[model samples]
Target: MDKLRQKDYFLFASAMYSQPISCSSLVEQATSPFVSFHQRLGCFHSDWHQHEWGQLIYAEKGCIHVNSRTKQILIPSGYGVWIPPDTDHEIRSTSSQTNIRSICFPVADNNGSLRQTISVFPMSTLLREMIRYTNRWNQGPVDEAQATTFLQTVQGLLPEEIDKAVIVYLPSTTHAKLLPITTYIQTHLARPINVQWLASEFGLSVRTLSRLFRQQLGTSFSGYCKIARIMRALELIELGCDNVSQVATDVGYESLATFSNNFLAICGHRPLQFIHSKRLY
Candidate 1:
């Protein structure tokens, strides 16, 4: 449970793995299952790389975009992404001054929420405090006696109870027919979303597209489109784009009242309140 020096993590992958195709061997014998670090994200980037240790990444500020072979996920504040050991992944920040805190754990699944692949966890108040506390402890001096107790208590714990922590899940799917339509919908959210119109444009019958949505995503076309618009609207607000009315119009809502209602329903916060609340957090 000893804290690592700056150079330790620089050679983290190399020290833990000689083969990029790492296994659980290194993690099995780790003295400490956790290592925490704070990093500021800018345009700085890394090539797709991996470690033998599983990682849980928390964005304390702004947004983190992660890309791997099967999943490209966004980790917003108050959310954590659990990346399994030996998985190929890359990370980027949408904002220049974004702050990220990551905890790397040994590769083990001991009846917990950690998955063999990437999983998103919602951060609870306690989990958030634990993260900050651990980081502060690591950065300050260490007491040999307390370090062992701290490590034992915190290392394998999940951020929150799985059900309680769950939030927006934007699944990136590979279904052939659904892929193009979903992409088109997300891209063209500024325009009205009409399933029949899409069916005409994509050369599929409206019934066929509706069936595809049911089979693949388990949601109606209108349901999915509304969520997409709300997501985009949130992004616009986060980017400081405009007032609520302007954002509503920008995302193709005919009226601010309609936009506010949908935004509240989907996000659990009014548009302006959400923006102000995010700044407070």
Candidate 2:
């Protein structure tokens, strides 16, 4: 393995968007397997992008918001996000402090037969440390063999299934009006949002928008919005926002009491209880 220069790294990262999709350098790095770790503090924006290779993104200290088409997933620590090749995605830091480590590797083929969406799974402490270690050792041959072994071990230990609560799919749609509405809901999750306002904004009748939600997303508009709120609440709580009431209000619930009730219904626990249980784990 050879340490990549700064220019080499940037050029490699850019290949994810280039045509005739290539990942040779990334594969060599993963096979020779020099891992590079990065940490970004404060809010940052990545424009809509696609990669020719698959990426594993883990939040080491805070939370990240990933928007891929109409579906959005909030990734907290102890969880890693998997993005398949060529899937357009963008990420943002939602917490005051956020740290993310990513490993990019080329897929063996571009068949598109397997899953082509984001997957979130639990990461053990050991796996986290191994990733960091691999990043530290990404260089010449002296550390190459050990790094390769560690990479294999980490990949082997990765969870095969995603948490049901952590996966959301954005259904592809052709309806022109629905795109802006979906994007608006995701960006303004903290604001009080209602169907009538959404309907009016898109020049859609409330009945029309409601039907569209069912037809395209396979869920009621309110149900989908609640799921979105739950995702936001999860991110806020993970960032040490201990005020459950404030978190609830921030996610657009009218009352803390109502938020608690709804959170229990969807997540099988109240907000505080979920946080407590996760801490124990």
lDDT of each structure? 0.64, 0.65
Candidate 1 weakest ten by summed lDDT = 2-11
Q: Put down candidate 2 lDDT per residue, 212-280, tens digits, no spaces.
A: 999887788888888878876776676566778878877888888889987787655688886775564
Off by over 4 Å in 1: 1-32, 43-54, 66-72, 82-90, 107-110, 116-122, 136-162
Model 1: how large is the Cα RMSD against the reference? 10.0
- Total residue pair clashes for candidate 1: 0
Per-residue CA lDDT of model 1 for 120-220, tens digit only, reads: 65566666677677677456665646755654455446634334442243556689888999999876777788888899999999999999887777778
C-alpha lDDT (0 to 100) for residue 18 of candidate 2: 27
